[model samples]
Every structure is written in structure tokens, then in C-alpha cells.
Target chain A: MMTDYRLTSLAKSLPDTVPFVGPETQERARSRLFDARLGANENVFGPSPTAVRAMAETQHWMYGDPESFELREALADHNGITPDMIVVGEGIDALLGYLVRIMVAPGDAVVTSDGAYPTFNYHVAGYGGVLHKVPYRYDDHEDAVALFKRAAKVDAKLVYLANPDNPMGTALSGAEIVEALEYLPDGTLLVLDEAYLECATQNIALPLPLDDPRVIRLRTFSKAYGLAGARVGYAMGAPGLIRAFEKVRNHFGMNRAAQAGALAALEDQTWLRSVQARIAASRNRIAEIARKNGLRTLPSHTNFVTIDCGSGPEFAKAVLNEIVARGVFIRMPFVAPQNRCIRISCGRPAQLDILTEVIPLALRAAELR
Target chain B: MMTDYRLTSLAKSLPDTVPFVGPETQERARSRLFDARLGANENVFGPSPTAVRAMAETQHWMYGDPESFELREALADHNGITPDMIVVGEGIDALLGYLVRIMVAPGDAVVTSDGAYPTFNYHVAGYGGVLHKVPYRYDDHEDAVALFKRAAKVDAKLVYLANPDNPMGTALSGAEIVEALEYLPDGTLLVLDEAYLECATQNIALPLPLDDPRVIRLRTFSKAYGLAGARVGYAMGAPGLIRAFEKVRNHFGMNRAAQAGALAALEDQTWLRSVQARIAASRNRIAEIARKNGLRTLPSHTNFVTIDCGSGPEFAKAVLNEIVARGVFIRMPFVAPQNRCIRISCGRPAQLDILTEVIPLALRAAELR
Candidate 1:
């Protein structure tokens, strides 16, 4: 039995658990380091030298401007949008928590693709919202139409779609999403998480109008920008919706060094391009290695490749455990069918080289099991 | 009429506002920079050289350990508690938001001193909690007895008390707080905000039992540690209450560089001592300057000194506005009596020199007004 201490009924009902355990926790439990640390999709190539310098030089004593003035100015300039349309926070995870709290009342319905980003669902649940999950399409892509249809059926106020979706590494075309957008009812908001859009060669990111109050788009510095530990993410929407964050969000969530790093990193498009090129090569190499191991790699527009283990969730999980046990960190999907695949991020050549050596051995171990 | 986007009943009921407008926002509005940055209680002496180096050398590519393993371990060791008794977050502001969310449901009762920290009240409002405010006693200090009595009477789920109280810059004795602890009801969790405790020369911080489920103490790197921009804060409490934070907190909310910098800052107590010495001398100089300007300075345990302008809130406002217009940044409290006092942070000698130059002129301007 737990001590309640008069915690809200919702909090009392929720389990004392976190959304995802970190690799460091796993490493501690295993008492070993991963030879190839690819899980969680952190960009191993790291941040731009300019950004690193910015972090060093940023005034660490003063609290960062809660307004995130300069960073927002740069982002607005780059996006050709006004600063009022942007609200930056610690990360997309933190923004999601804020958005969910502001939008979802107790028993309000929210829709998302089944086995999509679990963090969104985690937040939705924490706010006492009822969730409707639409299954992924046969190709393992998130079902855009189904999500919209479910939102309408449930009268959901919110829908979540992770572009170039996580785990599966599959994405819908921008046009495809625009078509589904017509089905969203009035007052429903689509939280489009484009965390990995930069890594994609194609700009599958929806060209949703900046003034469109129906959608909020999130971007992060953790992946292609290589500042995961800095925990910076921004949400862009209509001014009214973005401004709604002021009511509930932590005003000073932006870290000073992180903001400086993000500003410098934004200015270094050349470095971002280089990282994109490197990720493309790594993706190609990962696909090649998977082919050699007789595993089919899913077509991905994101930095990671999802290889079909050619069996079920258990087989893929065993393979994942084998890879992890051999000290190559990787993750797998949470649900059936897609769970038959294991996901690997765009590792550096050295880490990928280690991956190439161990994955086949892991497959052999999984087979033996 | 504004577009609602059908926000939650609670959110729709809430006024869209920020607790504090950042100085950068003011600078942008004025199209000018301040000569002195002494407001906001930030450590203008800046972070230690070792801390700056740590920020530079942090592993920016990786997500900070969600568990905050190294930082929490160091904090636990320093506090003579296990890591489980501590939970780190973006800042005390964020942890307060999360605590309010988890503890206070809609219509749940919470209590705090009327003119105490505004941010705590901000969070309580955002959560739709019914807040019962008790006015300060004649001493201008936060009335601990009044706060505890109000909490008991309201059957409050949460109570907030910031020692070395902000605005007034006065503090209570540890024994006095321990005496008030007797009035706290079983279901109420006392939220002890000790953000400025490290700056206090006296032992004003209560030696509350860490194992006591009735209270949680929050500390930050933003004040004496001079890492406000980093947004790193930790809450210490009974292991069970601390563990409860895992259910709702952003597990990876911490910035990588910030964590590294804080760890280094925690290790370098010599730097902390030097900063405290600087703050002490600065506080004394601020008091001396206020006396020379025909004002009285409150006895302060915090880094900032609140000067009684010997006038009402309007006169204090005039003085504050004149200082701001003259390119010197400082602030005044928002409530009466305390609002009669203008708060100035302990700036470096250069900044303090600017303050000394401006305060007399600002007072003259206030008199002219």
C-alpha cells in the first residue's frame, strides 16, 4: 500500500512509474557499457563546434530569458514566421505535458496512432483523458485517416501524429497528411511532432499554414542538431494557441546554455547538412548490414532504420536483448507486427562498425533461444 | 471574442499570463539595455570557472541520464541522504508545477502567505486549486503561524512557505518553523522553498526530518550556485513522496551541460564561499547606500535587500520606473507594505556602483512625480 497524502484522484489512480527508462539505467542494471550506443535515437556525431562554443560562453549566472527572445527571433526568421507563433520549452516532452494539461479535461477523448510515441499517451493519461488508438497501416506507417476518423468519432479535442514516425521510421507524405487534415473537426488540435524531419531527404513535413489554429508543430534540437542532453524543443502554432502555454507552462524552462547552443546550432546550417549526409550514409550501411543478416530493413525517412526481424514481437525482443547483452544498445517497437522489427539510430562509423559485427551474432543468439 | 480551441474547463477558466515578465522582454520593448542587472535575485557574480568549464566539456550529444545519476548521487552524498530521497527537475518552478499537478486536483484547498512567492500562487491557480491566502503579520515576514493555521482550517492538501522570504528579504528561525510544524494537518504536505538558504549566514533553514512525509524542501542552482539559466533544481523529501515525482515528471528534463556544471559547482565549495562573501559585502553596501538615500533596508538572509522607500507602493513604483528608464534594472514587490520596498539583488561591484549612482536620482524623480 502507498501513502496517498491526499494526492489528486487522478494522481492516486496512476501508477508510480516513468514513461521510458534511460539507457544509463539499463547500463547500471547490466553493469556494462554498450559497445554501440544507438538506442533512443541520440545523434552520436554531437553538436556543431560553434554551438559547443556558445554553450561555453553563455552567461550561466543569469536565468535565460523566459521569452527566449534571440532564439525565437532566429527561428522565426528561418521559418519566415512571426515570433508570437513560437513557444520554446525544455523539450517536446515538456511541451506535450503542458499542451495536454491545457487541452484535455477529465474524460476528454484524445486520439493517436496505436503504438506511436508513448510519451504523448503518457501525458494524455496523466491529465485523465481517455485515449483512442488507431492501429498502424499494413506497411507499418501511422494511419493518418484512421486517426482523424477516430478523433471525430470520439469528439476528441486532441490528436497526435509523429512525422517520420518513431520506432517504425515510416512517414506519410505531406500531401497525404493535408488530405486527412480536412477530416479534423472544429476545435480539435493536431500535435504534429516533427522531431526527425531534418534527417529525411524529402521534406515530408506538412506545409500547414502558420496561422492555421487547427495544428501545432513541434521541433527539437536533440536529433540532427545533436543537442539531446540540452533538452530544447519548440512548438509552433497560431498565436492564440502558442500563447495559451503562458497559463500553465514553466516560464523559465529554457536553459541558458541550451538556448545559446540552439541559437548557434541554428546558424550553422552547413553543419546540419553535414550531419544529414552522415546519417544518410549510416542508414545505407545499416540497411546493407541488415540485408547481409537476412533481415529486411523498413524504408525510413528518419535517421533510424527499422529492420523486420522476420518473426514476432518475442523473436524481435529476444534479438534486441541479444544485441543489448552483447553491448550494442538498440530499441524495438512496442506493439505486434511492428514489434517484429528492431530500431537502430544513425550511429557513427565506429559504433555502426561494432553494430555490424554484433547484430549477426545477436540474430544467431535469438535463433538459438 | 477570442478563439477558445475548446481548452479544458480549468484552463479556459484560467487567465493567460506569465508570473514575471523577463528583463529581455523589457529591453526589447524599450530598445535599450540596462547598465546594471541587479533585479531577479540572480547571482551576477556568475558561475564558478570550474562550472563554466564543465558546461563546455559536457557530453552535449547524449541525453542526460533520466535518473540524474551522477548529479543526484553527488547531491545525496552532500545532504547525507540516498539518491532516492532526491528528485531533480528543470527548476524549483517546474517541480512546484508538477507537485501542484500531482497533489491538488480541481477545487482542492491549498494555502500560502498572501504576499509570499507569486510563482507558487501562479502554479496553484493553473491547477484549479482553491487557494486560501493568509496575510503577513506586522513584522513584514511571511507569517508562518498564520499560514499553518489557514492550511489546517482550509483542510489544505498543500502549503507553501519560502524561508528567507522573497520581496521582504526577511527569514524565520529554524526553531520557529519547527514550532509551526505542529499545526500542519496529516494530509497537508508543506512545500518548503529554500532557494536562498545557501546565501543566509545563519542556520535559518529548518532541520526537518528528511523521512517526514509531511514536507518537501526545494533547492536550486539558480541562486547562490549561479546557474539560473541552467534550470536545474532538486526537491528533497521522504523517499516515498520523492518517488511519486517519477510518475509525472519529465524524466529527461535536465540539460546535459547544466547537470555537469552543477556537479562541478557542488564539488567546488570554495567558489560558493567566495560568492557568498561577495554577496554579503554587496548586501551591506546596498544597505549603507539605502540609508544614505534616506531609506531603511530590511534585515535580509537572502542575497537581495529590500529597501523601504519610506513611501507607499505608488512612490516605490515611481522610483522603480525611473531606475528602469535610466537604464538600471531593479524590481519592487507587488503587494502593499512589502510593495513599499524596492528589492535590489546583490550585483558585482560595477553593477552596484551603477545602482549607487542611480538610486538618488531615481528618488528625486519619484519626489518630483
Candidate 2:
């Protein structure tokens, strides 16, 4: 029950579970440092040196351009869109929350994958929207058609899909996604989260028409650009829909340091390419380690790899605990079947080397226990 | 007129006007440099030098500690409260927005001053809350009892009051606030915005019980701490109420650089005191400027001064525009009577010198025009 302050029934009904815990929280709880910090899929390669330098240089300003004119212009130039067609925010997390606030309301129907990013769902719940979740495909890819069908059936106001899915490390082809769009019911907006887009295989570009009124594509500096802490992201859509963000967004919400860092990171595409190369190598090393330990590694098109532990939830939990106990921080999916797999992120050579050495010991410990 | 998205009827109806346009936006529009940036009430002295150094040192991390453990622990120690009772976020603006999101829903009643901070009103409108605005007292104090009476009449769910208030630079003693608390009707939450608390006189502190479930105090690093660009702030209230933020807050929204900077800024209280001294000096200088121009200046408890331009809104607007054209940026209150007074922030000696030199010239130009 809520206090006498009179919170809405929806807020009073929502549980207090956080979307994701940072590795720092885990370290604090464990009272020791993780030997391999590969959780939360953060790019351990670090942000571009130039971006870091720029943030450092501009640390004295009160606030950045409320319009985010410079960063928006740069993003538009990079994406071949008009500056007015974009809005910059703290991160895609914040943008997701705002989009829900702009669109969904009490009793409105929203659709998403069953085990998708919980933060988006949290926003929907906060707005009192009813969520209809579709299960992932048996092969682990997001079932785009199923999502569209669900949205149509519920007359959903919004439908969320993360291409190059998380937790399972699977992806839907751009063409596959476009084909599903035909099934999208009228007046249903589609949210295409492309957070891991840059790190995915080059063939996955759907290039949703910018003029399409029903689609908004979210891209961020957090993942491949390695600037999650800076919290900068953007969404592209028809100018009309995008402008609605102005009606409610905190005009000066964009931190000056974040805008400077993101601009520099975007310009240094060379660093991004290098990080991609390193991430690819780290993924392979993880898969090799899993194979050596007699586990089945799911084929991945993103920075992280998920390996089937060849056991039940209890066994997978045991294996994960053993690794974490051994000072290797990693995570697993929260849902059934998917929870039977362990997820590891791409990092530097030293981090992967530690993971390579620890997986076998963890497996053996789990078996013995 | 919302597109296919199902916005709350209230959200669909909210007006798009924000509190103020950022100085950066003005700079972009004018395509020229403002010699004096006295707008936005930002400290021209910037943040503590120590904060600048700290942010520069830690700009490359992926994400900060999600729990904000160290900062909260330090803040709790400083405030004589437990860390669990504090919730840190991007800034007081973000915190106010979050508080509104949790407490107010479509058609929910909320109350504030007619000419109070527009940002809070903007948040209320965005969430579809019905806003009940009480006019400012003739003496320029926020009429606390009148606000309570209005809230009671409307059965308001939340009421906002900023002590050492913005725009007016006036304050109510803690005793006064606590006394007003008694008039707050049952089921009403009081939002005590103490953004300028540290800089206020000794009389501002009231030994009110923190466990009184009716009130939540908002604090920030934006004003006296001079880290507005960093976007770090916190809310102090009963643990039960504070815990509710976990239900919908962006779990990883706090910036790593900002966290580090705020921690260092908190640690260097000696530097903070020095900034306070400088602010006091600047405030006096602003008053002198007003006096020399034959304008009446209010007694200010915050970092800015409200100078009555001895004219109507049109004259105030003319002087303001003339100052802007003369390359000194400042602002005025949005409503009548209050609009007769232009607000000027405390700045460095150089910035103050510019304001001193420009006020007379701008007034003369306005008179001639």
C-alpha cells in the first residue's frame, strides 16, 4: 500500500525490482573484486581517448545547449537526416521512459518480447500501460511476426523489439524485420532498439525509411562506443513524432560533458572499428573456452556470447555461482530455458584470458558440488 | 492530436513551453558570444576546482556505481541520516520530475505558486495532473498557508514550495516551513525544494522530524556546489518513500564523471565555503548595481538578486532585451508584478563588472527606444 501521499493505483501496484544491477553492486555485495568484469555487456575496451579528453576539457560549464544543436546536427550529418528529426537524452533508458510517457497511458496495451530489457517494461508499467509479452523463438531470435500479431490483437499503442537481441545473443535479419512490419496494425508505433547495431554483422541494416510514421529507431553511445557512463543516446523518426519529445523532455537534461564526449566518440570512427575488432576476437575466445569446457555456445552476432550449460536451472545457477565465487563476474538470463545459459561480455585480452582459465574450474566445481 | 500512440488524455493536452531556454540556445540563435552569462542563475565561478580535476580523472569508465554507494554514504554522514533515506539522481530537475511521476496521475490534483518554477509545473502537466496555482504573496514570499488552503480545497495530492526560492531569491525559515506543515491536509505530500539551502542564513534550519511522512526535501549540486553541468542531485525523505523511486527510476542513469565529481566536491568543504564567500560578495555587488541604477533590490538569501526595475513588464522586457543585445544575458519572472523585477545571478568579478557597466547603458537605450 502507498503512503497517505496518494500515489496512483498503478504506482502502488508496481514491484520495486530494478531493471539491471551494475557490476559495482555485485562487487560490493560479494565484498571482493571480480577478476573478469564481463557483466552487463559493457564494452571493457573503454571509451575513445579523444572523447575522454573532450569531457575532461569542458568540465567547467554550467549546462550544454538545451537544443543539443551541435550534437543533434552532428548526429543528423552522420545519419543523413535533418537535425530537427533527432533528440538527445541522458541515454536510451531515459529516451525509452520518455517515449512511453509520450505515448502510453493507463489501460493502454503495449507489446514486447517476454524476456526483453526490463527497463522498457518498467517505463510501460510506470505509465499504467498493460503489457503483452510474446515469447522468443525456439532458436532464440526475437519473433518479430509474433510481436506484430500481438500488437495487432491487443491494439497495442507501442511494440518494442531489440534487433540483435540481448541475453540470448541472437539476431533477426533486417529483411526479416521488414517483412514483419506488414503485420503491424495501424496506429501501433514500433520501437526498434539498435543498441548493439554497430557491433553486429554488417548485413543487418534494415534502414527503416525515415519517413515511416510508425517507427522510431534508438541508437546509443553506451555499447559499441563505450560511453555508457556518459549517458548519451538519440532516436530517429518522422519529424512530427520526434518533435513531440520537445513538449516534455528536460530542455537542459543533456549534460555538457556527455554531449562533448559523444560528439568526439562519433567522430573517431577509427576507435569504434578497433573496438569492434577486439570484441569479435573476445567473443571467439569465449566460445572456444565454452567448447573446451564441454558446453554448447550459441552463435552470436553481437559483443556477448551465451553458452548452454547443458543442465537445469539449479545446475546453471551453481555454475554461475562458482564462477562468481572464483572472482569472475558474469550473468545469466532471468527467464526459464534461457536461464539455463550463461552470458559473458567482450573485453580486453586479459579479461578473456581470466574467463578462459576460470570456466573449466567453475564447471568442475559445479559438477562436484 | 497525438499520433497512433495512446498518450494519457492529460499528457496529450499539456502545453509545450519549458521553464527557460538555455543560454547555449540563445548563443546559437544569435550566432554571437555573450560577454556576460548572468542567465540561468549559474555560478560564473564554476564548480570547485577539485570537482573539475576529479571528473577529468575518471571520464573513461563505462558506468558509475549504480547504487551511488559512496556518495550517499558520505551525504548521509554529513546530513546525520542513513544512506537508505537518500536517493541521488541527475539533478533536482530530474528528481522533481521523478517525484511527480510517482505521485501524480491523470486528473490528480497538484498545487504550486502561480509564478513558481515552471519545470515542476511542466512535469505536472506532462503526467496529466491538474495544477492548482496560488498567487505569490504581496510581500513576495511564497504564501505557504494559502497554498495549503488551496490544496485542501482541491484535495491536492502534492504541493511544491522552494525555500530560498528561485526567481525571487527569497526564503522561509525552517520553523516557518514546519509550522506550515500543520496546515497541509491529510494525504497531501509536500515537496520542499531546498536547492539553495546551504547558502541560506542560519535561521533556515528547522529541527523537523524526518520521519514525518508528509514531506520530502530536494537538494542539488547544481546551485551552490556549482556542478550544474554534471547533473547530480538527491532527495531526502522517509526510507519507505525513498524506496519507491526504485520502482521506476532509470537504474543506471547517474553519470560516472558526475558521481566522482560530486563526491570530490562534497569532500572539499573548505573549497565550498570559499565559493560561498565569493557568492556573498557577488550578491552584494549585484545589490549595489541595482542601488546605483535607482532600482529597488529585494533582500536575497540565494545566489541571485531580484531587482525591481521600477516599471511594468514591457519596460522590464525592454531592459532585458537591450541587455541581451548588449551581450549580457539575464532573465525575469514570467508572471505580472514579479515580472517587474529582473533576476540576476552571482558571477565572477569580471562578469559582475560587465553587468555593472551594462545596466545603465541598457536602461538608457531602452528609455530612448
Give the number of the best model, judged by lDDT: 1
Per-residue lDDT for A154 in model 2?
98
Off by more than 4 A, model 2: B1-6
Question: Which residue pairs show backbone clashes in model 1?
Answer: none
Please report, as a residue range, the 10-residue window in candidate 2 chain A with the lowest summed lDDT: A1-10
Docking class of 1: medium
Residue A71 of candidate 2: its Cα lDDT?
89
Summarize candidate 2's per-residue lDDT along A19-80 as a digit string, tens digits. 77778888888888888788778888888999999999984547777777888999999988
Scored against the true structure, residue A54 in model 2 reaches a CA lDDT of 92
Question: Candidate 2 recovers what fraction of true contacts?
Answer: 0.66
DockQ of model 1, rounded to 2 decimals: 0.74
- Candidate 1 regions exceeding 4 Å error are B1-4
Candidate 2 clashes between residue pairs 3 or more apart in a chain or in different chains: A90-A231, B90-B231
True-vs-predicted CA distance for residue B179, candidate 1, Å: 1.1
**lDDT tens per residue, model 1, B143-178:** 888888889898999999988788778899888999
